[model samples]
Target: MTKRAGSAGRPTKPLLKAPVRIGSVDARAVVGELRQLHEDAEDPDVERMPADDELFGALLYVEKHAHALRRQTPEVQRAAALRRVQLWEYVREQVDVHQMHAVDDARQAGAQWIELAPVLAVNAPSAAYNKAKRLKAVELTDETPQARPLRRTPEAVLRAERRIASERAAERQAQEVAQLRHELLVPVVERLLEQRESFESDEDIDYWWEEIEAVLPHCQTPLQMVSLRRYLDAVLRALAKIEKRTARPVALSEEALLALAAARKVRQLDASR
Candidate 1:
């Protein structure tokens, strides 16, 4: 009889073995082993099974074992879930202990809650504060006794009233001074405009404006300064129109003329100083 293929010359390859049934095995232990195997497979130095048949066999083994665990009785599943809860609670308690230590150490180092907030990984300083408060991890100090209120004499009260009245009178006097300054400057600006209607060149006009600008800081109020600036802007626009040879002169409002006068007076005051 002819020898079976390859048996006579070379030993035949061994047949693939059936996966072992995982019946009645400790499901948690099996899962833990599977997890370890997965971690080992993920190692860069470890060589994985290259053949498709070998890979498939490994996959089927894990699938059948996992399916068996999933199909276990309801009581077994409940016990597994309870074990997981217990494990998680233990982890949480350890984390709480660590956090409490961290907070206490920070407090001992004289660090404020706001300063410690960023390092605690909380949403905000206030949240960190609340957490520290809940843990009773913050240090406290003794409160000072409250002092009794003092009673003022009638003469003292009268003196305070007089001081307040004086302050009001001073404010009104300052306002009047500012108003008088504004009124005096307006006419000076109008007179300057009447003197210089047109310029020979843009350079001359620019120089003229610069001279006026040098005195602007002498103006008492911001309103006077702002009005002066508006007047200058109008003057520049009018010059631009004149440069274009436009027949119409840029119109000026009564308020703008007053502003021009005020700016000119500010210039004179600045020169005198």
Candidate 2:
């Protein structure tokens, strides 16, 4: 094309501007389409699964949690939860590890199980029911401390009530840790702890005992610090204690969950009164 002379006497043609459009191919669509063409379809993938040893370690964690929760308190239970929160926060921010991996099974493997809440437990409805009953057992109506004429004295009753309250707190803390342990460890424990026997061996008992030992130091709740050695001696009784003798899993039944919730509500009311 020939240039045209401008009014200012400079040889010029109106610069034919490139069609100012925004698309993969200068189409009449939207601005975002061009960026979409360059964006990656998927992120770089790598091995996320824990190694064999790491998997076993995860199972150990599950076992530990289950053992602890059958008898802990709310405050202690809450601390266990904080541990999980810390792991994820640090991992996402790519932070270092110090008090890492509540179990630390995979410390050498260097494999991180980046899952959030992947463990599951199979406990009877009764376990939770028992937990609720212990926690929310307080009362306030006509059963005033001094008014109720019991074989036990007013001082004894007060002392008993205080003791029971402490015991209940321990129970709650245990329950919370139990929940955490089961969720993280159930699958792996099921996989690794597959010794086909009705009764656990003395070694098995020892392992279970060790788990209790590890978390008991962290057990600050009332009654939680008490040794379970006696129960462990009565192997069958210890099995019965957890309702772990059975393989079947039952959610807290409607009646059971309600009972626990009822106890909780009553306790809440009593505390206010």
Candidate 3:
């Protein structure tokens, strides 16, 4: 009899394959999730919720993911470089389209390089200004065959544009003031030059007098109106000289004479409002 019955050997189970790890991950999302986990783990109240092991597990998971990302950094950079090149190609295409259109047409269609900069996402709004300058240089070179290449940073281009615009606005304002002065004073000056006996009528002189009066009320400084009145006095004196030289009788109305006298009496023009 033998020996005691041998214990049945435990049934063998088939070996299972390890789970496959992902080769790629979204770095931004992973970092954000890991940051949240770290915050939770460090919270004072977390001890009452998840145990120490759970907190440590979250940290370990993050560390492992970080290591994986570090290993894949070269590949990620390569992909990023490829994407940047593609985006620049798209920008060049847009530049070409802009160049093909007439300047006014491009402006009206919102296809100008400055306008296209935003859609291209080259950088911050203020930092994307160089595309227009660069495109313009390219066009000039193509046309002239030997034009020098232009290379300017976005910031430099922006500053230059602002300076040019301000200068243009100032020039336009000066031209407008010159035109206004011509309209208001030139005809009277011409009449004086021609040695006319008198103004066309009292109403003609009144029209100019009224214009000066209207401008005086809106003058920012007393000196501005004073200067205008001085100029008016000069014109009246010129007229008076012509009349005296021709030995003509006094033709100016009493009101015109009084106005001229008041202008001549102004000794100093004040800058005070």
Model 1 worst lDDT run, 10 consecutive residues: 14-23
- Residue 140 of model 1, lDDT score: 18
Candidate 1 vs. true structure, TM-score: 0.25
After superposition, candidate 1 runs with Cα above 4 Å error: 1-151, 198-266, 270-273
Reference-based TM-score, model 2: 0.16
Best by TM-score: 3
**What's model 2's lDDT at 80?**
41
lDDT (tens digit, per residue) of candidate 2 on 169-228: 999987876555434333322222232133334565556646555544454443442333
Where does model 2 exceed 4 Å of error? 1-152, 187-273
Better of 1 and 2 by TM-score: 1
Per-prediction TM-score, please?
A: 0.25, 0.16, 0.29
Q: Which numbered prediction scores highest in lDDT against the true structure? A: 1
lDDT against the true structure, each candidate: 0.50, 0.35, 0.44
Cα error, residue 272 of model 1, in Å, equals 7.1
- For candidate 2, what is the lDDT? 0.35
> How high is the lDDT of residue 196 in model 3?
29
